[model samples]
Target: MKMRIVPIGDQATLGDHRHYPGARLLLVCSLCGWDKAYRAERVIDRLRELKSGGHATRLEQVARRVAWNCPGCGRVKWRCHFAWPPGFDDREAKRLANLYRN
Candidate 1:
């Protein structure tokens, strides 16, 4: 995989992603407090996904903003995610792996 440099939350970093081709994305939703992690290459990819497949209308508005209210929870804490360095401690790594299993 090519190491792509994308700007995220005012910080730029190299990451592995193909969906978003130019800039990195960090979404902090105010709806569900899910704090989703996304590596977006451009604003358009996020917008397009929300407009088409993701079914998240809330995400579309928060695309370039640092913080916004989430649609799910009616609170910002539950719905937003920001640019954070992805270093998985052992426990976190294990927890994430569990998501892939049945």
Candidate 2:
């Protein structure tokens, strides 16, 4: 999978993803080259409530269980990455596996 670089200052508009109460999660779509900051807590809570799997805490773990369709291409096989704050490096972005994508 290729990592898409999320431009600086663009993370604020990704989505409702937030790591903490006020913090957000920066993510990138390796397939479509799309990137955004999503509201982590809200998405996680919703996923836990909607999906049959048990609760997941980590970003990658949560993504694995959640139903995420890429807004760029509407594909379900997309992966999400944690864009470490301060410096958004494509090499360091962690990949969330979509085991069910077919």
Best by TM-score: 2
Q: For model 2, state the Cα shift of residue 52 in Å.
A: 4.6
Scored by Cα lDDT, where does model 1 land?
A: 0.41
4-91: candidate 2 lDDT, tens digit per residue: 3233342232232322122345455556766666556556666668674333444555445545787897765534554445543434
Tell me the whole-model lDDT of each prediction, alpha carbons only.
0.41, 0.47
Q: Give the TM-score of candidate 1.
A: 0.28
After superposition, the stretches of candidate 1 with alpha carbons farther than 4 Å from their true spots are 1-24, 30-33, 46-82, 88-102
> How does model 2 score by TM-score?
0.41
Segments in model 2 whose C-alpha atoms lie over 4 Å from true places: 1-22, 51-56, 66-68, 83-102
For model 1, how does the per-residue alpha-carbon lDDT over 1-102 read when each residue is reduced to its tens digit?
A: 222223333322222232233223455544444444555435446556556423233333444344555656765453222332444245653554565342
List TM-score per model, in order.
0.28, 0.41
